[model samples]
Target: MTATPRAVDAKEILLTWLTDQVSVPVVSTRPDNKDAPATFVRLLLTGGTGRHDRALHTTQLTIDSYAPTTAAAVELALAVDAAVHGAVAGLSPVVRVSGTSPSESPDPDTTSARATATYQITTRLLT
Candidate 1:
C-alpha cells in the first residue's frame, strides 16, 4: 500500500495556500459607481483518511472593491496557491473551489458603491 501524506505536510500546504489567496493579483474590473477597484482571493482543500486522519480544515479569502470582474478572483486563487507553496512547501494535498462571483450592494453606501469577491477552502476526514 502507498503511504499517506503527513499532517505537517498537509498543514504546510494549506497555510501556503492561504497565504497565496490574499497576497496576490487577481481578477479585476472597473465599476461604474466607483473607481476604487475590486479584488477577490480564496483558498480551499479537502483530504485525509485512515489511521492518520486529519481534521477537515478550510481557508477562505474575500476581496470586495471596485477593481472589477471575476478575473481578480481567479488571480487571487492562483496567488494563494503560489503563496502557500512558497510559505509551506511539501503540502501535497488537493483543493477545489466551487464558485467565483462578483457581487454588488443593491443599496448605495456613503461611498455609493459596493462589490465583493469570495473564496473557500475545505478539508475532509476519512475513517
Candidate 2:
C-alpha cells in the first residue's frame, strides 16, 4: 500500500538496525543445523497484518540474543530493547514501534544464555 509498489520488509529493517546498534551479527533464521555464534542475535517475524482501507500494517517481531553468559545476555537484551523500543520512526519507509516485552532464559547449551525481546510495529503506507 505504499505510494510505490514496494512494501517494506520490517523484519529486515529491524535486523539491520540491531546489527548496527548492537554491533553484533543478526540472522533472519538459524542455519539448517549449525551452532550459532556465541554472541549473536536472531530476528523473527512472528506475525503481520494489513488494513487495506487505511493502508496500514502491523508487524510483530521477536529479537533473540545469545551470549556466553547470563549477565552478558541480559546486557545485550537490554541494549536490543532500548534500540528497538523507539527506533522505527527514525528508519526508512516509516514505522511506529510499541508493545515491548523482553525475556531471558538459559540456553540448552547450558554454557550460553538467551534473551528475547518482542515488539509490535505499525507502518503506514505513503499515499
Candidate 3:
C-alpha cells in the first residue's frame, strides 16, 4: 500500500490536476499583491478521518471556484466536480476520490461568486 500523503501533498495533487485539466489558477490562498483573476480556484483541506490500527483514511477537502458571474462560477465548479468526482491517478496516498458535494454563494460585497466543491478522498494511512 502507498504511504499516506500529507495535507500539502493532497493539495498539490489537486492543484496539479486542476491546473492541467482547467485553464485557471489553482491556489492555496488568495493572492496578496495581485488583483484577483476573473476566475480562479482555491483548494482547502477541511477535515479527515483515520483509525489507530488501520492504514486507511478518508480526507475531506473543498475546492472554491471564484468567478465574476454566478453562471461562470457554476460552470467552473462543475468542471472541477468532473475532475474530482471519481478516481484520480496522481494522488500518492489517495486511493480513490469517492464523491463531491457542492455549494455556492456571492463573494462578500462584490459581483464575484464562489462555488465550493467538497470532496471525499479515500487513502492508505502511512506510518
Q: Give me the runs in candidate 2 sitting further than 4 Å from their true place.
A: 1-6, 31-36, 109-111
Per-residue error for 127 in candidate 1, Å, reads 18
Q: How many collisions between residues are there in candidate 1?
A: 18
Better of 1 and 2 by lDDT: 2
Highest TM-score: which candidate? 2
Tens digits of per-residue lDDT, candidate 2, 51-83, equal 444666677888788887777887888888888
lDDT of 1 by residue, 7-115 (tens): 2334444444454446532332233344433443322233323222355544454444322344444444445444543433333334433335646532243333334
Off by over 4 Å in 1: 1-55, 67-94, 106-112, 123-127
Candidate 1's TM-score: 0.31
Per-residue CA lDDT of candidate 3, range 26-124, in tens? 999865455778788889888766442365667777888888778889899988888775335654666778555557866675567888877877766
Cα lDDT computed for each candidate against the true fold: 0.40, 0.73, 0.73
Lowest summed lDDT window (length 10), candidate 3:
2-11
RMSD to native, candidate 3: 3.7
lDDT of model 1 at position 83: 50
- Deviation (Å) of 12 in candidate 2: 1.1
Question: Which portions of model 3 show Cα errors greater than 4 Å?
Answer: 1-8, 32-34, 51-53, 86-92
